[model samples]
Target chain A: MTAAIVALGVVVGLLGVLVVGLLRSHADVLRALHDLGICEDDLAAAGTAEGRRTAGRRTTRTTGEIRMVPGVAAPGASSSLGRLVDVSGVDPHGGAVHIGLEGSRGLTLLAFLSSGCGSCLDFWRAFATDEVEQVPGRDTRVVVVTRGPEEESPSEVAALASDRVTTVMSSAAWDDYDVPVSPYFLLVDGSRGVVGEGAGGSWAQVVDLLRKAAADAGLALDDDRPRFTRRDLLVGRDRELRADRELAAAGIEPGSPELYAPLHAAPGDGADGEDGAR
Target chain B: MTDVSSYGITARLPRGWDARIAKRPDPAGDPAGPSTRAAPEEGISTRSAPAEGDPPGPLAGTEHPVAHLANFPLPPVRGDYGSGAVELMRADDIFVALVEFEPEAASTPLFSHRGIPRFGVNDFSPHTMQRTIAGMCGAQAFFNRNGRAFCLYVVLGSHALRAPLVAQVNALLAGLEIDPL
Candidate 1:
């Protein structure tokens, strides 16, 4: 009886290993299907397995960071983002306002901008216009966050303040949001934490953000017309091409980032090392 | 004047000055380091560095011009110079550097020498070359030829030595010529 028990234990161990191996193979098949762009609804399209596709959302790679494109909310999208913290900053009207990010009844776009950023400057004119009062979606609000101290900021930044857009200059709010680049956009749902974050260089890019935010919230814009057109996208692309030409005309290759980085100095920093009368 | 040819270009060395050319390997290799020894006349090596956080080692002791030729590595930014080799020639109280850099396809804008004195040989006129101050330097010559640019940076030990080194730096700058393949 003891000899038979030892043989039975060996057989059971082999069965366990086989089960684990099968489970691993099944997981591999599922991952391969996801990589092939087979959604959960189409898992049985190719006569493959009938199981649901893994719920992992595809991550879009952008400069310096990975961002998820707007799509069906992946599992635990809300739980993944922690709560937003309250930050104190000064409004454009010189009033002290606590930005709790909770008072917005609908979607709120926090546009992180800087007076020094060339990209942010491109959208300043559009931002100063009356169109900013009605940012495409219903009940959505747009808030501009600039670095604090009104006296230290450029006049162009101050020009962005109007009835439609609320301009706040708060270094504390900028740090709290962990924004590293200017012309960055954060779409926040009312008390729902961050819904999406992206970098925008122009007003069209901002419009693009509104469109994506509206889509994800299962909300439709009151206006059927799209703010961005094929020509508008091409115009943005042309700006980059023109910059390359100017650099090339200067005999500096636009492709060399290291060389270009040094050539570009902040205004009044003096690219040339020597001062006057040297 | 001694005619020194390297990297498909020819440059005139200072009357008694010597130059050792380092070439880029065909298959590409590491950038030139501080490997070349000091010349017998210069009586200095390029291998010395000050202890961490210390002021430039040799200049610490005296105000008098010292002849200390040290090997300084190429700067972090690579220049148009084929082999990024650099050396600091400290003669008496003057600092002279021979640097090479690649020229970009776009023309680098020429700066106006409004208040500064401009001096250069006829050889540089065709190349849009000019003499400008490099931050209290005794004199500085910047010129680009044959898709490469050269900067002859000279800092005199004292204002007293300015007159003596001015001619020497100019002659060295005039001697620079591009070797057309």
Candidate 2:
């Protein structure tokens, strides 16, 4: 009996060591995956409806919180913001093209995508099919930038390019922007430099992320209403003046008792009978 | 202004303007040898048709550099003289093409001008366009610079509005520098 008890203790200790070793290996694998821009949580959440709903709520709530705390960089904020400059590269037809980012009006959306990335395929399709719309109210120019000719096949990029969009094959732009992943995006305000940037798994997610970024930057993304100009303000002032002139002509001056008549019929003041005040 | 230089061509592009310098590609299957084609009477031909049983002719007798500058966004794909992008220009936009020619052509009478020619509003004409675009006017000049032959082609989006646009063009030309081969 003494020998059996000792053997059992040794077996239990070995099992505990084995479990710890397994956990250590699993953690190392997860860390490696994270370094590759993949998180196990994201992978698991990508397929479930509840996870997607939760992600949407989280994005909205986080954006609201960011608005409350202006100028504070959110956790995991991308470093690609404010790094975009002029983008120059050879087109698929071997022609050199330069796109100036300075002094440009409206927003320029730089979509840094790759041809072989599985996650980028959906974005490519969305851009090609016009499923993605420009940021509402802003004249967002979408320029699809791919790796240079040496690293990417121009033919494949051309095939993936949309006629409506301007595609530039520029590996230098990728380096200049310091893109961390295949399907990263940078939103630039020509006058203000880069305002927002992040990675998105789908077109919808990208739009959400961009909208949130724009909001955090204090940009009115949904404010499509016509801007109130100086002329409008002048017209409003003129209308008010005309109304004041008419009121004065009718004997209603600044100190007119009629303006305060509604307040004078109160019970505390005793300006009228109790029944009238009531 | 942004300084854009490539292949010995340099230009200071103003704000709202962009430029690109590209070397003309060699004729397919044509081995490196002396070009057999003769220089065309005109200094530049916007479009040339392949002659039957004749070797594909290089523009102005050899492959040369072409630089395009415009106030509007230039598309990735464009012809030697701004085909795809010119159509997208607004009424106030400007497109400039600085095309180089063979060194020998520098001595030809067509390219005898000493330096880049300055343009005035009267220099632009609607009929000068490779393809006549409504409300658009174009001007072309052939000149020699540092033993190099070049053609300057400028297009104005509006003929009536060419005065200010011409001033912008001359300002751009004033900043252009071409290095000797």
Write one digit per residue (lDDT tens) for candidate 1, span A155-227. Answer: 4454454434556677876677776657777777644666766665567766876788667755556756544
- iRMSD (1 decimal) for each model: 27.8, 25.5
In model 1, which regions exceed 4 Å deviation?
A: A1-83, A150-156, A217-278, B1-181
Residue B97 shift from truth in candidate 2, angstroms: 1.6
Best by lDDT: 2
Candidate 2 per-residue lDDT over residues A37-144, each given as its tens digit = 556676688679977777765455434333312322232344766664888786554556677776555577888888888878888888867576644434677788
Please report the candidate that would top DockQ against the real structure. Answer: 2
lDDT value for candidate 2?
Answer: 0.69
Report, for all candidates in order, the number of backbone clashes: 16, 0
Tell me the lDDT of model 1 at B70: 12
Model 2 misplacement above 4 A: A1-76, A79-84, A89-95, A123-140, A147-165, A169-172, A175-178, A203-278, B23-64, B102-104, B131-135
